[model samples]
Target: MAASPELEGTESPAPRGPRELRLYGLNAVHAAFAKRPEAIRKLYLVQSRIPALQPLLAWCVAHRVGYRVVEEADLEKLSGSAHHEGVVADVLRAEPESLSTWLRDLPAGPQLAIWLDGVGNPHNLGAILRSAAHFGVAAVLLPKHSSLALSGAAARVAEGGAEHVPMVRLGRTDNALAQLRGAGFALAATVVAGGRDVFAADLPTRLVYVMGAEGEGMDRELARACDLQLSIPGTGAVESLNVAAATAVLLAAWRSRRPG
Candidate 1:
């Protein structure tokens, strides 16, 4: 069946999962409050630590966000561990945007997007999202299969990037690539061998840089779909750069070339 553009950027309702909002560590909680305070529904702090949390408490109070000073054990229970560092916040999950919506929303200027073929690691995914936000990429595309969702770990690692960049989960990587190609995007896949150096490639403004999983690299179907496959040159001593590191390097290179 021919793929319809209807499903391009649509997101189904968030799946029902854990009830309480789970956020651990002081830094993570602080990041949410500072970057995306509207996501915070309630702030939980240990009674004895309220003094230490005075600044955060004041912000919550001023924002009219709910807060409760509970026992240490209660905070731990709420966060699912004792590593919360005496603070926990009930925050809404970051919403995922449709790929089509992101593409349409692109301003009348240069546009770039990153597509992950089969990334399963939350940290790597999060790091790439952070890089995309930093480089002003239009959006991030992930294959529905074998792709990690935007979890708390991803959000924490992104340091608020997850909230800024739109993330679209595709039903199939190959199909999504086809759609992107139809929309005038040049597909450039990062491969270990048999590809030009990324720096030498004629990466255009509307390019989709594809990065595959760490162990498997780009699959045959994905590699074949690429208008060009590129590699980040490295010393023979190391096999290749990690996906996240490669993403940063590729994004930086692309951004540097854009007309400023």
Candidate 2:
């Protein structure tokens, strides 16, 4: 252990409202209701859209969730987005699971996780979470110093994927990597060069796909920690895929290789 390198990290932004996370749009609101209705502190709907939202309203009433039927403009103001689609909610805070918790809970089969250097943008984070859910990733671990916060915009972009996948905050990168290795997860770091082609390579069932900021790529130490360095083969003139696009591609590959 090289003095632990002063590992530091921050939890994803705390829920926006007083012990609540502001959520908007049909997909996000529906996910919140479906997966954790008890966490809904308050809900808002456009008056004209009530008929279309009756089922959700009924559930809110049955669950004793506070709600207000307001004009569409009110929803716009609340959500700060024109595409709110007439639904918004102040859902309760969701505490992120610890890295150790998820690792300990792994089932008997191979596990899949996305270990991110950091989420440079909320939309990118949302998109990655959506892909993670689609491919059944157990969790997404962010670097300790990551400034990325799962904001309302992120939830909207995720289209409910945020509710399905867990976001884990990591401490010293090396420490987490070591624990993962001990747990039998083979780390595969993504790189632009000097790596195996992800699609054709032999992938481990218990694996963590490592992705870093595009401009800097993975840090030297992090790259050295991986069991196999890999890349998504591409022939396009573009220099490289953005983090979200690359993640989706890699995840799809994982899904294809282990189809049910």
Candidate 3:
């Protein structure tokens, strides 16, 4: 939630837009620029990164966007993270879309999505976004009460995956389920145990994988409501794989069965 580095007196006023976010890391900044170049309000980078970011620099000069060449330590201090990767940008945060809007605009196909029941870790969310982008996931469904939102660390960890995936806000649980069912999507609850093996199960064409939190797991009522319960087979080595890793595995399984 930290804002980007403030420009000195030399810079002009930032353009009005959505909430601003400080995005460090080369790939994260690059992705934001590639997706919405106009959203970039200000930029700060070490001299060494200039060559790789020549296009962006050219855009900044043409548009009169504020940019500064500072020392590595200055970037570290400004971004409040050592992983700035010699570049940082102030960009407008992409807002989440309502369920109705997303559903209305979604194209019909063998689409895939994930419903985050209680997954809250930013790193896990980033990893899930990365996997979701890799597997062509349509949207990330967030529950009504969920507090999850895109953050600087999550974007950095996603390695540009965040730009490709849209976070969608769900309505009432039952209503959301009804809408998805009407859209020809099957809900599959991913449980730690007592479920059909993912590798052997007959996956649906339009499927939404419901993932729960780490310790408390999915809500009992929600899990029971799903059309199918799925579990990844493991040797009971250490309870289960992390939620992000499990998501990647489940998505891969689905894609393998229905390759495009």
Candidate 4:
């Protein structure tokens, strides 16, 4: 396996924290309530926003989750975002299940999924997940070393999408890949160059799409582990699309080609 020139910059100065993560904004909070209300630890809202949040509040109260009325400044301080729309909640981490667990849970037939090899930006992670959910991707997998952050900002940027997608950590061991392949998935690596155009290529019924992180592209080893590689045919207007943009386009193509 070849070393990635991109791996050198993977180290970050910022520290990571425990599993509990704070989520802010009305859309994110409401979506969480709809999908996984039990995960909510606490809720904070501006008194002015209370009238609009009655149903949500009622649900929270009935479920025994605590809520407190706070000023806008307090809401801002609580969420670390001015765009929080006067709501924030501390919730359990939404980390997804292991590859084997996902495999065991399959209902039937063909499926589609994605793996993020070295994606760095949280907003991009959130946006990619939103696209994944839109195209019915079963889950989004990331390597243990990936710098992707499942943060409050990410959930906010995802609008209501954070509640729908499953995000998991599947490292570079290739164990997950082997299991997926044995289960009949054809893993396709997406590259900026040196592959057939995705628009014209044959796609498998069970597939996993691989994308490298921004600025540094995919790890060479991880890319080589895939069964095949494909590229999005683009004009020379720009060198490459951001990882999130490419992911959305590729997923759209996958959806468009189905036998619906």
Candidate 5:
């Protein structure tokens, strides 16, 4: 190998911060129109394609929401992604709840929360957040090191849930679990190999359902910290269900068991 591509001076691109360019697709935009019109900053539509998006336009007009007719290129440029689906709406950043404040305000009754352990995928995180919101979860906690803030895809997938739910960034999983336990919430982790079936477990009134990352389940220490390790009953055909699907199942089961 004569001069195998010799290394030349190369500079890596600068790391980017949380997504500044937010694009809401058709479905997400429609949902915002119905639930959070005030959050929308600007709506961009193609003039020729106005007929297809009449409802959106009408809602914007009725709400006095500002909008503009722009070309497809402009939408792509603004979104910084090609999956905008012909409609893009710029929105203001939704206010986030402080982790300490959320925890401090817990009422003197049962509460439900979701803890995400090293869940790296934004789509999965977003889906789980949506499920958490649907079942009226009290809060969602994530280990600061392994989890990421809500992203554009997450915002889109979450629909309106991202705006409604509270997200907490705890620095360490073990410490977070300890705090939850002290607060009278039972910690339960979803495990694959050895754990009780979620459906049969007598879940406590206050619960923190800890979900692990894809492929790699919870770490041994974290699993041991859980008051119980639970598994979803499923056919043994697949390795394991996606984290998001499992989250929905567990959440639904938990919600059903709540006392009226």
Candidate 6:
């Protein structure tokens, strides 16, 4: 193991935040630094990764941010996962903006977003975020009571997409529904069956796709409150597509109609 590189300027790592995350994977760490270099608290990586991370290391040295070249085992221990992919970073969690604040700042135009009702799995969330970013989703809306939050594994799975998409906090269901409607967004509740075919449905320009949980599905009342419901027609080989897969398909369907 190489000796930890000493930072020349700063006295120590930035004060640890209440919810700091240990982000891993080359893409995840690189994206985090690209988006917010100031938020990086510390970095750890294997010796072989140094060459590929010259720019990041240079930034660390310039900003007086501490970094260490450790063994692969050390990287795994630091990240709490074997899939750290040669690098790990401790970064402050980016807090989600409140619904009102997001609404206030949103530009008037065609947009798309997803409302994650009960999809709490970190990997699933990561996949959804990755697709959302690929399709230029406006944001991911989280209900006030949802326990869904970004995690290290999620960031790794997202492969940099997490940095591109914003998460919004919605306080109450009724208020959130009304707010979205007032903003000219038509909510489309995605269901497994008994809904319009996604490929054929007239998707709105400003739309919110309500994604349910994997097993129990979305709340019946919430589905009823939506402007319309949509389903993906599939052969009866399986019950339905996984929530993450379904989300990607929905976003793709929406994107297909809005060719610029």
Q: Model 3, 197-236: lDDT tens per residue?
A: 9999999999999999977888999999999999999999
Model 1 per-residue lDDT tens digits across residues 1-260: 22124223434312225443456556667776777777777776777777877887888889998777666766555555546678767777665566666656667556788888777887897788788888998888877765367765565677667656777767666667667766788988889877898888778778888888889987887788789988888887988889999999999888888857
Task: Give lDDT: candidate 4, residue 22.
Answer: 81
Whole-model alpha-carbon lDDT for candidate 3 = 0.88
State how far residue 94 of model 3 sits from its true place (Å): 0.9
Candidate 5 TM-score, true structure as reference: 0.78
> Which ranges in model 1 have alpha carbons more than 4 Å from their true place?
1-21, 24-31, 34-36, 45-59, 62-64, 69-87
Backbone clash tally (model 4): 0
lDDT of 5 by residue, 1-260 (tens): 11112111213211122323365566666666666667666677656767877877887788887677766666556565566667777666554455566778878787888888778787897798788778988888867665367766776777667766777777565666667777888989888757888889898999988888788877778888788989988889987889999999999989898845
**Model 6: runs farther than 4 Å from truth?**
2-17
Candidate 2 wrong stretches, greater than 4 Å? 1-18
Clashes of 5: 0
The lDDT of each candidate is 0.74, 0.81, 0.88, 0.80, 0.73, 0.91
The clash numbers for all candidates, in the given order, read 2, 1, 0, 0, 0, 0
Worst 10 residues of 5 by lDDT: 1-10
Compare the candidates by lDDT and give the number of the best one: 6
TM-score of each: 0.78, 0.89, 0.92, 0.88, 0.78, 0.94
**Residue pairs in clash, model 4:** none
Candidate 4 runs further than 4 Å off: 1-17, 147-149
Give the TM-score comparing model 1 with the true structure, all chains together: 0.78
Question: Candidate 2 at 34: error in angstroms?
Answer: 0.6
Strongest candidate by TM-score: 6
Off by over 4 Å in 3: 1-18
